[model samples]
Target: MAPLRPFLARVEAKTLLAVLLTAAALWTFVGLADEVAEGDTHAFDESLLLALRSPTDISDPLGSPAIETAVRDVTALGGVTVLTFVTLSVMGALAIRRHGRSALFLGVAVAGGQALSHFSKTFFDRPRPDLVPHGTEFVSTSFPSGHSMMAAVTWLTLAVMLARAEPRRRMKVYWIALAALVAVAVGVSRVYLGVHWPSDVLAGWTLGAAWALLCLLAARWLSRRGDIEPERGGP
Candidate 1:
């Protein structure tokens, strides 16, 4: 019993951090939403969105055509088709590994995140940036960039699962950091493409991160109760 005290302490600390981070993300989202609703972010959004384009010609993006192409490729990582493929592939792998429960959980988390993004866009009904020509096509209203939110949700959820399957703390951090990097890149791409305001990307990143953390916490709780498989070599 005494030997397990340190392990329990570590678990508690991690859980507390997750909770605090989730709360912070949610709070930030609310603040951003309020600012957007009140049009307070208009100046900031326009300046940043315009900065990505050529000063003399707003139609052309700042970089060479190659860079623009590369950015478009990166942005595609968050597109519906790409994200859906990645999600299905990961779920399939999990099921094949005999972790059907985790696969189902992954599907639920991603689907819920998608629905949240969709409904939020509909609710806000914010127009896409009109400051410059949009470099890509878009269909939904653009309060929260769907690409940014889903990138975070899908990649981060997968990262959490990958981290769970590993026992090394360093590896866990690596997976999560990589996921965050990808999410950030996707969000920035939305702005660079002039399809979404900077605030829209910010809102998406925060809300998506909050959702992913909530799912991670839920998975931990379920694992503790033996409702799901525990992390590798975890108590």
Candidate 2:
């Protein structure tokens, strides 16, 4: 019991940090949403959106054609098709590794995020930015970018799950960093392509991250109750 004290203390500290971080993210999202509804973010969004495009030609994005193409590719990583494929693949892998419960949890988390995105977009009914020509196609309202939201949801959720399974601290850090890089890239690409306002991406990122953290907290609680696999150690 004495030897276990330090490890338990570390777990408690990490859990507390996760809770605080999740709360902060949620608060930020709510604040952004309120500001957006009040039209306070229009100037900020337009400035950032225009900065990424040529002053002479709003239709032309700044940078070489290749860079624009690359950004489009990155943006696609957040699209529904790509996100769905990646989530399915990860779930399949988890199932194969006999982590079926984890896979189910991931499926539910991703699906719930999708539903949240759909409902929020419908409720807000915000229009996409028209300051510049859209560089890519969009099929939904753009208050909170669906692509950016799903990018964070899928990538971060996967990262948290994978990190839990990894024994090495460095590997855990690597996974989280990589996931964050992907999510940020996707959000930036949305803004760069003129498909979404900067506030839209910001809101998407915050809300998505908050949702992912909530799922993580739930998973930890479930694990503690022996409702899910312990993975590397008991929660």
Candidate 3:
């Protein structure tokens, strides 16, 4: 109890909050995954899938073609090629700015997330929803939507990077809000396209959010320990 005080003293309130939130989200994801695997979520997943589609035709989606095309574009924002390009581009920018630590951090955070997403899919081995015709082609197991995870990772990572450089509180808020919107859009697009179960997107969101927050917490700790520079103006 006495030694706990010293450790607790070193952690900031916000860091502690992030840790708690991350734990809560991660546990939620785990619970959902277990239930999904046990088939408890089958009824709910199918119901939600049907509710989001045209009542008359599962093949025909709910939106206009133009809107469907727009959703595809949004979903593409989380596609492998797009995320890879965005990751390299942002890391390149960080390196050019001489924020080597930040560049490395971003690289590991995203790459790790990709690997984790893959591992989760393989582990769960959940098939994609077949109740409707898929709007986009995909080639992976589907317990968790990869697009949803990547969207959260890329957008949230960029949001943190940009927010750190912002001095104004509102600017930081704006970046975070915009990032959340994009992430949510990607998840919704997955369900709308009939490529993923609603639970898959929920799991992806929870896992991705937890992972991003964990990375942020690591960045904060490393900055304090002089292992990495803070993102005050640099990385």
Candidate 4:
């Protein structure tokens, strides 16, 4: 009798599926961003960005004062200070746990994403949105919102790592979903704040998600091959 083949559980299958879906999204957004950079998507991008604001008052955001305050607080979650602290803290924990490979991967993935964000801004030289006053100041080009990209990279990267230690499939789903929620909120805040075009945030989300998936897939493969510390179990 032939030996039975190994059957992947739902979680394992979903992880592989996520890589494929994220890749497609990454390519789709790359094309859109290129269209934006070429000035082909300006009408669409501007319309979407403006739609999120008050129709009568361009300077005013659509939300009430309290909601606006909440949004600003959420947006701050994607800021450099917050993301950096979170990254360092998570990496420190991983290192202390003797998962050096995970720590290295997290550091490399985030740092590389930051470098890519900077290079992309320079390469595109796209100006910030000017149809309305910006709620937040910008120091770099606006092709891809740095806050959005780094937020996605940081949250999604952490989500993937943290999810692996989850023994239950539902918990894994929740972790990834929570990460996606934060990333989406950050991107929306950039547009709401009148700092980035819709396409810029979309590009950031897709690219950052892609980068996170790449890191996760690499880590998984390495662990299987005994090149890194395998997941020790528990969240």
- Measured with C-alpha atoms, the lDDT of residue 127 in candidate 2 is 96
lDDT value, residue 221 of candidate 2: 90
Q: Write the per-residue lDDT of candidate 2 for residues 1-235, one digit (tens) a residue.
A: 9998887787777788888999999899899999999999989998999999898998999999999999999999998888999899988987887778988998999999999999889988899988888999999999788888889988999888877777788888888899999999999999999989999999999989998999899889988898776657433
Model 1 regions lying over 4 Å from their true place: 1-11, 233-235
- lDDT of every predicted structure (CA atoms): 0.91, 0.89, 0.87, 0.83
- Put down candidate 4 lDDT per residue, 189-211, tens digits, no spaces: 99998889988888888888888
Off by over 4 Å in 3: 1-6, 233-235
Reference-based TM-score of each model: 0.93, 0.93, 0.93, 0.87
Better of 2 and 4 by TM-score: 2
Ranking by lDDT: 1, 2, 3, 4
Give the range of the ten consecutive residues with the poorest summed lDDT in model 2.
226-235
For 59-176, candidate 3 gives per-residue lDDT tens digits of 8878799989998999998898998888888888777877778888888889998998999899999989888889999999898889998889778987786666556788888988
TM-score of 2: 0.93
| Candidate RMSDs in order | 3.9, 4.0, 2.1, 4.1
Structure candidate 1, residue pairs in collision: none
